[model samples]
Target: MNTIDEQLWDYIDGNLDAAQASIIKEKIDTDAEVKNQYEELLRFNLTFDKIELEEPSMSFTRNVMESVAIVPAPVAMKTQVDKKIIYSIGGFFIISLLALFGYVLYNSNLTMPGFDQKINFNFNLDKYITPTTVYSFLFADLVIGLIFLDRFLRDKIVQSKKI
Candidate 1:
């Protein structure tokens, strides 16, 4: 019942559909409360329309704008690089690698220093596995985790600034 005024206000603002609006209009014409609300809204709207917005002083604008000093737009964390330059560098490296690989393949003749027969790779895990190696792997993972955390925090800070 109390919210009927809000609905009437919406109707006055033309936010209601044509059919609903017409119905509300009929209510405003026939119902005392609705008509009273409509009149009040009209008066308030007219008053609001007549009111003038205060303009900021020229010095205020000048001071604020001057304080805001011109800065270059924010760039991506991963700087934009020319794709052509990257591709050319990659192409050069790849071509060099391919040439070297081809040369090696063509010139290669396998010979062991002391082996009488061909060496077969029967890779035994027990021969290479050690406690220090496990600790080293754990340490490496921790450093990687720290780096990931730093990057994540930095990104979050940048995102917060954007918002």
Candidate 2:
């Protein structure tokens, strides 16, 4: 709205100090436009004062709370996982690892020397243990460690939230 309406509103609400109120009062008395606006605002204020606000029924809050209570509480996404599914996945991985280890051992060739014969241990591990192999193994270990740490932290957070 214009400054005139704002000043008139302030004057009607008695928000303006004596000096500002007197200036607005003088304008309302002398200017026909100002006088008309002031009378309209005064009628609106009186109408607003006469209005009776309707209140809600006494059981409104109780009814709303009862409906809310009938609805189920939300469950965490992680908590929705079934224990049987996790156990099955873990069992599958364990069995696969055991089978792989057995296959490796069964295919390998190694001879055990008799007690009467001298045992010769002349195997060089340098060929199998290259720098790249070592770095890859370390990187794999770091990635696995981070995965485990992440799982541990997530579980901790879920547990804390439950409390």
TM-score of each: 0.37, 0.43
Total backbone collisions for each predicted model: 0, 0
lDDT of 2: 0.94
lDDT of model 1, residue 74: 73
RMSD of each: 22.9, 14.5
Q: Mind sharing the TM-score for model 2? A: 0.43
Residue pairs in clash, model 2: none
lDDT of each: 0.88, 0.94
Candidate 2: deviation at residue 83, Å? 20
Candidate 2 residue lDDT tens string, 73-122: 99766746898999999999999999999999999976666747777898
Give the clash count for model 2: 0
Give the per-residue lDDT digits (tens) of candidate 1, residues 58-145: 6998788777767566776997799999999999999999999999988998665877687888999777778988899999999999
Error of 2 at 159 (Å): 8.0
